[model samples]
Target: MRTSRVDTTIFGATSLLTLALGGVAPEQITVPAPVASEDAEAVAGLWLSADKTVRLRLDADWSYLGRVAGRHRAAKGTYRPEGTGLVLRDDTGLRTPVTIADDVLEMAGHHLFRA
Candidate 1:
């Protein structure tokens, strides 16, 4: 009688690499983490909803946009500070009101947080 054994070594190597990338590679990367200078806290980074169903991001270029559950485009617009609130203006020229309190962002009766 003859018996054969199939190789499983490749999967093992892939699994090890995946874990190492998660646990070790991120630290070894040369990219610098963002620092919150007083000016930086003014704008930037990922934002999301209280229900975790929506997400948004702001860049220094004055560009702002939002997604639904990190998948579909829900809102995209330009944003700027107006007093303590933010004004989100869509391409259609429609404007929405956004307020930031502590770490929570309130807009259209939905609450969001910095993520």
Candidate 2:
């Protein structure tokens, strides 16, 4: 008799596997900074592509929706306004951190001029 087996994981799904293996509880998720609602509103507006690389224009009216990577993408989520900072998220459940000051949105330390 012979038997062989190997464990495998799909790409982009490792996060889930890691959580399951480590038995990390949902409440244990660590958020670097607590987002505030007020800060989200401050960044709601039409943002143009400055570098023309990412090709993202943010439209935050009632909720956060924007295009990213030169593609027309919509993200349904909330943001916590932090003074001059904004944190965005979407239905896909991804958190995007950005800071807005004087009409400039600083996404990942890169500032995008207001359109």
| Model 1 alpha-carbon miss at residue 90, Å | 1.1
| Per-residue lDDT of model 1, residues 25-63, tens digit only | 443545323323333346578888877887778777667
Worst 10 residues of 2 by lDDT: 53-62
Worst 10 residues of 1 by lDDT: 31-40
Q: Which residue pairs does candidate 2 place in steric collision?
A: 36-80, 36-81, 38-81, 39-81, 39-82, 40-81
* Model 2 accuracy (lDDT, Cα): 0.60
Off by over 4 Å in 1: 1-41, 69-73
Question: What lDDT does each candidate get?
Answer: 0.70, 0.60
Cα lDDT tens digits, model 2, 7-112, are 7855445567566759665566553443455443445566655765443344445365565665565556665565446667778778887765556667765667
Q: Give the TM-score of candidate 2.
A: 0.48
Q: Count steric clashes of candidate 1.
A: 0
Per-residue error (Å), model 1, residue 39: 4.6
TM-score of predicted model 1?
0.57
